[model samples]
Target chain A: MLNPTITEILLSLMQVSYITLIVLVVSAICGLILGTILTIIVVKKIPVLKQITVTFSSFTRSVPIIIQLFIVFYALPPVIESMGFSTTYITATVASIVALSLYHGGYLVEVFRAAYRALDKGQHEAADSMGYTPIQKFRRITLPQTIPVALPGWGNALIHLIHDTSLVFALGVVDIMGRGQLIAASSYGMNQVKIFLIIAAIYIVLTFLSDAIIRFFEKKNKKFKLDSGLNTKGA
Target chain B: MNFLILFEDFVQLLAVVPQTLLLAITIFILSILIGTVMALIQEYNVPVLKLIVVIVKLLLRGTPLIVLIFLMYYSLPDTVTFLSGLVGLDYNGTNIPPAIILIVAVSFTVASFQAETIRGSFLSINKGQIEAAQSLGYTPYQMFKKIIAPQALVEAIPEFSSSFLIVMKAISLGFMITVVDIFAEARLIATDNSYYVEAFFAAALMYWAISAITVTLSSKYEEYLHSRM
Candidate 1:
């Protein structure tokens, strides 16, 4: 009773889930890698590089994701084509993933950098005094500690990226919103309202799921703290 | 990569500044006015209105802005017309402008976030200050006007400035619904000239510059407020 095109709605849901999962994985991986690198650069105070990272982060943060998507989707192909790369590979999905990952990566950089900055100066001093290598210090102390600090912001970023996936439909990608568009078009807009309301509900469920997952991690972190008598401060 | 071409592109993008500003400023003002009311309701804990505000805030925050705009611009009219027909009323709801729909959708989202920001600022005001004002024989309105309002307004400025930048970026979404803002204008020029990169690069620069100026101004204002304190 939601809409006459229940099957289309289901298909769109599947498509939406598919796109969201891909985007989530792609953006998470890209964001983490890039964010970590940027955080490290900042932590080390790499002369001009730190300034560059800061500027890049602020610029990316300021730009709208939709504008970024359009720029990448339309502009990137021509640039790639000029570089002797085929533009055929840059579909709407690819453009969406690229733009979304980069956008999320900028935010993740802030989260990761802030988390690093929040750690007590004594932690680094202790590691240094113990003759721990920089890599060892990062792996054994910083990485583990930063996770709890970064989790909430990282979770919010992922949820935001998921919400942004709905915009891929604007690029003609058959995401949930695109699916709604398709169904509305096919049904001559008879069920547009129902289709969109259903899509909104789906988004709500996705965001709630992400929040719950973050809560689960928070609880686990709390339990770990209680057992080990170690606490990671939230900044 | 041509400097002259890029300059031309920047000009084309700049030409649409008026429309972009109109969209951003209009929605921002509406959102702040409406958002303040919504925030005050939650602040005072009005029974039914508080519940409704919570629900509305959640609904707005949970859904993507694009979905809201799409629904308002496209689906709402058909649904309205159909409902009206069922009640034996002849109404055509399709004549509303996309700009108006964009405003409504963007304002709803902005208001939700603004309500939260405004509420936080309100909560940050200490009870002792209000008590002091009360002891001075100040009316409730006078208490708000003289003490609570000043502190909250100063506190709210930093957050409000960032939201102002956000509203500016959001105006780009109006392009999706064909509202002829700067983003839309850039897209048109890019399509016409087939220089997508140059056109969009110009658009990005303009957006970045506006936001950068906003950040600088906001920080300066915040410093001035702190100096006053």
Candidate 2:
């Protein structure tokens, strides 16, 4: 066994921590945008589209994100390569974005669907009596109400996405977990167990910080009173 | 555009259906089995076991599942090698079953989640129901078996169904640790054959079937139980 050292451990933890935050940001943004579009289509209630949205959303949620990343990283390049595009960091980033988007879209659809379903019918009827069109009613009433109702589920989605972002390590993204595993392997060879411990500590730290952000949002959004109002109904 | 090719691989991927379902069902059954027993212990406030249960639940709930899978894979072989060397079993040289490892890791994870749901369900029952069974001179086990267990299971059905789906989907992590489940196999086929659409669509179909069957089964159970009530 190699002699144990403090320096190697510190270096490894630093590298892994930075990667974790980057992956979290990338995945969360991707999930947010895709979630919005899917939420719209799902709420629009297009005849065939509703079933399509539900099916796609639920399937995405049910499948493993690690497998999703593997499929995207491995399969997407060749599919896109047919158009004479070479795979690069941008492609990889875009592919991860798509994967994260698809994964979180499943969550967003659920949030929105539940939000739309939970609103009392009287509000819509009230809007209708005022001669508001479906789109207008949605814009003025349904959409506004959905925001608060979806806030809590949306928070859960964000938390899940942050945690799920760790799976991107398997896709060769070298995210936090990827970096940790690398450092751990290297440290094992070098007899630096403290590095592995430090890296693990970093994950715990980030998770704790993330939980705080979510809890803060949840408490701050209590004014909407839509959380309980939403959880019981459509979801 | 490539629908026919995808259709063919989709059918090919169906071969993994049984394995996926088996993993899911095993984890569901075993976790619930473990979870219920643990929950019962918590209800009785069993001292040392309760502390262990709390810690297990926290770690299980706190860490991501993939991390647990990795930790288990590495830890088991090391332990097995050490044990075999000590006991002279001389059997550590053989490969351990990936499916079994995956089942154990995922089941424990499910148990952490399931125990919470079961406990919640159990506690939700009216106290009088338990006392009523006790007043009938029933022992704690008899009271739980007759009155509490059935109600908790029914109350917990929806959460359980969703958790089952999550666990079913989670088996895809096996591939990361080099266990060739359906998704893992599809990744190889897609990469080797350059049939991304075909391979992934095929896997997606299998995933859909699994999801459909679970949802249908749970709903059926829900209806049957409601009618009986």
Candidate 3:
């Protein structure tokens, strides 16, 4: 087998970026929904549901991503098949997304919880006095305050999610890392170093790019001035 | 779903717990040592060293652990050969074990994160306390031992254990480079019986247990530090 050309590597990286974008967007949305539900359960202290969410969160937090990926990849099919769904569509990419979304959701639970708890109770009471509905209170009061506080943690999680995408290649998703492995292996490992270096450079670029975007939001969050006197009395 | 197979896989995975622990602990200690030196370099503004440390840390932060492991595994031999040739010495890099390479790579990656933790804790020391210690004619060592070390250790413990958990997770990547740590052992068992799910769950359980223990211990130590103060 011949060593891959630069164009081949670039094309592979393009494919990687595409998959990464899908994973990030889908997982972020899923994670937000999961995190909100878990946060609600925990905040309300909903008996069995709270315990189950807590245990699930801990499990996601502790298990290595690779193992989690494998478990999901191998286990989801059987479960889905038993539910009368075809297991044929449960590809490596799908399993990776599921696993990563769960990990993201688990982490966001803490971020949401902390940000939610940091919110001043007076704001809720004030919203209540105004005869605001629950949705109105959440939209007008809860979100604005918690988001600024949560932005930093959320951004950190985003960066981690980007890093976690690199692991998806282990599940044979043909992402950048997987492509690099194939390129090297096809050439009898003669180009392993070069391929690995290229892969690393790609990952670094992705991480820094996301980090800069996160920082921009973080800077914009400063305008809220939520960290000032308003929230101080609550703590 | 098969409880018996899961139990058997769990036992098999547990047998390799020592290997995983040894790797995790060694990497943790080595990284801490390297990270402290890097932190000290930055803390004291040690001229050119600070720039190099910063660059290394940035690179480490950006790159994934598996990439680092692969890069080191592939490049170290050539690097060793080149250095030996330059030094007029006979050395072969192929003789080095995969475990050593994994340790070195993971240590560097973990060290970058640890350096930040150490430096943050170091900076958390109050300037007034240092000034007071100085006025008392205490030596730097005395100031560190009497005042700085305790406070910094307390501040650093929580972050350090988080890094420890990271180290634990990172060693799982060792399976890629043929290091038969717990995760690797699990994969072997799964391949043998096609019980990948059970094998992975067992591995996950061990990882979860280790993390729980680390978190509990660190929090206890933090409490002890608080009580002492």
lDDT of 2 by residue, B96-213 (tens): 8877778888999888878889999998999999888988999977887889888887899988999888787788888866767678778777778777757876787777777787
lDDT of 3 by residue, B70-182 (tens): 99999999899889989998999888899999999989999998988988998999999999999999999999889888899999999999999988898899888889888
* Chain B vs. true chain B: TM-score per candidate: 0.90, 0.91, 0.95
In candidate 1, stretches whose alpha carbon ends up further than 4 angstroms from where it belongs are A1-8, A78-87, A223-235, B75-92
Worst lDDT window (10 residues) for model 2 chain B? Answer: B58-67
Candidate 1 residue pairs in clash (backbone atoms < 3 Å): none
DockQ of candidate 1 relative to the true structure: 0.63
Give the higher-TM-score candidate: 2 or 3. 3
Model 3 per-residue lDDT tens digits across residues A49-122: 99999999999989988998899999999999999999888999899999998999999989988988888778
Off by over 4 Å in 2: A1-7, A47-49, A74-89, A122-152, A184-200, A226-235, B80-95
Identify the candidate with maximal lDDT.
3
| Residue range A26-51, candidate 2, lDDT tens digits | 76777777777787787777778778
| CAPRI level of candidate 3 | high
Name the candidate that leads on TM-score. 3
DockQ of each: 0.63, 0.37, 0.83
Q: Could you tell me the lDDT of residue A202 within candidate 1? A: 83
| Candidate ranking (DockQ, best to worst) | 3, 1, 2
